[model samples]
Target: MKASEIRELKDEEIVHEVRRLRRELYTLRSQAVTEKLENPRQFGVIRKDIARLLTEQTARRNQAKTAGAAE
Candidate 1:
């Protein structure tokens, strides 16, 4: 998923999306080990997307914390 698409999601949706991506990564790894994965590159893409989502979430949280502290 693109970062723009991820940004469009609400916080709750992003949380769910992260969980779903992790599950997909797990499943892809299992398939790869079994020599059944049709597209192993999907694993790399999913991992990157998860990282992007987590980074965005963390930045948002930190921003909120800083704003709260300044109030």
Candidate 2:
């Protein structure tokens, strides 16, 4: 998914997506170990997606914290 598309998702949605992606990643890794993966590059793509999601999550958390502190 594109970062812009991900950014448009709500926090809860983002969390759900992250969980789903992680599970997929695990399955992909397992496949890679047991057999040759058709698309070996998927691992890197998924990893980057996870990182992007986490980065967005962290940014939102920090923004919330700062806003709360200000209030």
Best by lDDT: 2
User: TM-score for all predictions?
Assistant: 0.92, 0.94
Query: Would you list the C-alpha lDDT of every candidate in the order shown?
Result: 0.91, 0.94
Model 2 segments more than 4 A misplaced: none
Per-residue CA lDDT of candidate 2, range 1-71, in tens?
Answer: 88898889999999999999999999998998899999999999999999999999999999999999999
| Worst-scoring 10-residue span by lDDT in model 1 | 31-40
Residue 48 in model 1: lDDT: 98
Local error of candidate 2 at residue 65 (angstroms): 0.6
Error of 1 at 17 (Å): 0.4
Evaluate model 2: give its lDDT: 0.94
On residues 1-71, what C-alpha lDDT tens digit does candidate 1 reach at each position? 88889888889998999999999999888888887778778988999999999988998899999999999
Report how far off residue 33 is in candidate 2 (Å). Answer: 1.4
